[model samples]
Target: MLTEKQVVELLETIYDPFLKKTFKETGAIQEVKINKEKGLVSVKIALAKTGTAEQLQVQQTVVQRLKDAGASSVGLRFAQLPFEEERTTNEPIYLAIASGKGGVGKSTVSVNLAVSLARLGKKVGLIDADIYGFSVPDMMGITERPVVRGEKIIPVERFGVKVISMGFFVEDNSPVIWRGPMLGKMLKNFFDEVEWGELDYLLLDLPPGTGDVALDVHTMLPTSKEIIVTTPHPTAAFVAARAGAMAVRTNHEVVGVIENMSYFESKTTGEKEYIFGKGGGQKLAEELQTDLLGQLPLGQPDWNDEDFAPSIYGEDHPIGKVYMDIAKKIIAKLR
Candidate 1:
């Protein structure tokens, strides 16, 4: 006879497409009943939606995995995601930095942009919504965790910007294994549980791709705006358009698109190198009916090692000037 625990271990292999997580991680498995004599197993799962292709796939996977676990037959049922009213806020201007695919330096743009806004004497709060691949802490050189007081969390302050990320909660370089529902809950806590004082801007460094977390933000923050980041590579622009389309579909105002790594400048000869190609940002903006906010150069910033901060160029640095200009435009739009 298969034990309930064994059945659970087998079902853990099944992943939800939207959540990008296992049933076990999402706490979707509400119950597991087994009939030892009959060698039958029954499972109840929590899902965001029912009777969909993905959900049907999950159900089929459960049946096969359970049968492989020695059950003669298996029964599965799904319960919709528990409905809850998440806290809502309309005080600060919420800006989400999003990308169609990962590894285009979205987080780097987020960290620097937030810092740039703060540099202009604006109170900024940044949320690292990329739970699975969180790197904001390391990029900002944040070693300390968020301090808890009563039921609220105090965000860590760095370079004049207040920051909170999954990096502060989990072990260094550890993975965040959670389901879609959990991701929504965690995002809500960032607004409800964290004591974010008055701010001019609350920036969310969204995860790559149009996943559950991004959907949660879209649904939760109706007034929030978005900034799409993409590389100069044409293929990258194609993918980034999906992200921009999602923003439009969600009815979130797209502040603009920032073209990263548009070109590399030769130090000695002062010649421009379009290493990743050019016009991707402009193409994306035209597709989305928006403007290309700014084009960023590929280079490293000069940082003070004693602070252990990422390469955030000051207003004097060329890259820093670009960010400052973008931040000013965003401020103008918000105000």
Candidate 2:
């Protein structure tokens, strides 16, 4: 027969798969009582959530480990812990890549940053939360819907980064009319349904400006920060500033700013040209009191250029170097 202390020692070695913590560390083992005379040992355990296979497996493993550790008989049961349902605060930093204007290359920045992060050997995920104009599938060259396993939806993976987008669900030529509660529920499903596992960063590509979708994200991911994108054109910067300020109001920290279409490099002349005025990026960052992270050129206007694929799937292109620099700045700012 085993004492409660000995049983607990063995139980401590069993870890919760999802939470990535040992039972003992998570306070899952509430108490251990060994009724030596009755030849039974009972464990009161707390689970992170209801009906998670991983949690149930941890419970079963605890029972076996306790019995194997010398308990004559074992019983394991669980109750929910109120606060454990939130994603581990230890999980990777989440950054929302948003723009105040459409056609500013926000999705492109999100996709490239995700790729750049993965190239640095960090596990990364990109969530295309822009329901109205989802573009991740085209940007990533993915055509398949996510795989469904048990209760978890596995994001589509390519070039070492995992991606999930509404583009995978709705019609190609058609637009989604999801509104109100339905929209919120569908977006929330991405959190609960997707098996993100562990990641170093998860970038959400939000649609332009203050809108219903942006509001939903702020509410759901209260800790997520924002990175506003803008162009060098003054008015665009003015509008982009509103976005940064809105993020501040929502308690989402503005990590920095990105200026897309800041300049164009003449392919033939090989000279930098600010086709769209100037100073918008720096001006926006200055007003927001944040870093002017980087400027992305209007490189090869058609992303479908045969050369672009190599950049994503292969090692590095000159454009890849630019994105890598921005990725470095982003990681530094987040830290």
lDDT of each: 0.86, 0.80
Model 1, 312-334: lDDT tens per residue? 67778899999999998888877
| lDDT tens digits, residue span 1-335, model 2 | 88767777777756456454556667777888888887788988776676776666676777677767666777767877657443553576788998888988888888888988998888998899888788888877776789887457899987778999888887754888876677677787777678787889988999898888788999978999899999999999988888898898889999889998888788789999899999999999999888888988776423556434422523355566788998888877777
RMSD of each: 11.7, 6.9
Q: Assess every candidate by TM-score.
A: 0.73, 0.75
Clashing pairs in 2: none
Poorest stretch of ten by lDDT in candidate 1 = 81-90
**Which ranges in model 1 have alpha carbons more than 4 Å from their true place?**
1-90
